[model samples]
Target: MSIQKIISTKSNLVTELLQNIAIEEDWAKIEQFTIALIDNFKDPRILPGLVEKINTLPFDEANAFLVYACGEYSLEDCKVFFDLWIELVAMGDFHTASNAGFILANLPEPFDFNERQLDQAENKLMLALSKPVTEEKALVIKEVLELLK
Candidate 1:
């Protein structure tokens, strides 16, 4: 199939998966879909639409999908993930922030962070660490902190 066709097909798949998540709240399906999508990680033609569709879901669900996307797909230009991550952090969604931080901290070669984004991430991480958080979230936060350091 043509690249455009492949992207279109995958984009449709993501949209369907998002709908299913909304109707069923089945996170397992999200994971499965993410794993499949990651196979095409290098071809990010669908990312814009996928991210937009993900944003329409509830915060928790949207965050979950985005976290998986970040972890699984290490794109060269990851402004999409970076933007969403910053937005999530600004919204005080620490769990998702941790995932985003982890992604940024481990971004692949040719994808280094700029000083301002790094500073913003550090500031957000510090703020999140000071807040009351669940044990699971604390662990994630610590992991991201260690990676950033």
Candidate 2:
């Protein structure tokens, strides 16, 4: 089957859709589609906002999206995302922070954080890292960190 067809599955459809759009170099569509998806995440009518948020997240916004998807996490969950951000910080790039806010704006409540909230950002990254890092994602995060460092 075509790549697009394969990505049509519900499980990873959103991620795959974004990936295809990214590969096609279609930022405009990505941004627009993402905006709507993000909005849905803010106040989901169907599934939990996190579910859709995680689905639509592309590689570009994985960290932010992952944190957002995890929702109002316990201390343990916060650490996963925090450690990941630190690795990003050590690389001297703050784009992760930007993405974090982008993802945060769509959260339901309580867990929502502002852009300048480094403490919260750190927590999110730690939360992400604490979880089992998939092989594909691990490679990408490592590469980005290396490039930034």
The prediction achieving the highest TM-score against the true structure is 1
Q: Per model, how many backbone clashes are there?
A: 0, 21
Cα-based RMSD of the predictions, in order?
4.8, 13.4
Backbone clash total for model 1 is 0
- Can you write out model 1's per-residue Cα lDDT over 1-149, one digit (the tens) per residue? 89999878877776665455445445677666556665643454445534654566655635755665756665444554675665454443556656665665656667456888767876886787688877776666677667656
- C-alpha lDDT (0 to 100) for residue 145 of candidate 2: 37
Residue-level lDDT for 53 in candidate 2 = 42
Q: What lDDT would each prediction earn against the true structure?
A: 0.61, 0.41
Cα TM-score per model: 0.58, 0.30
Instruction: Estimate the lDDT of model 2.
Output: 0.41
Off by over 4 Å in 1: 1-42, 77-80, 86-102
Q: How far is candidate 1 from the true structure (C-alpha RMSD, Å)?
A: 4.8
Positional deviation of 123 in candidate 1, in angstroms?
A: 1.1
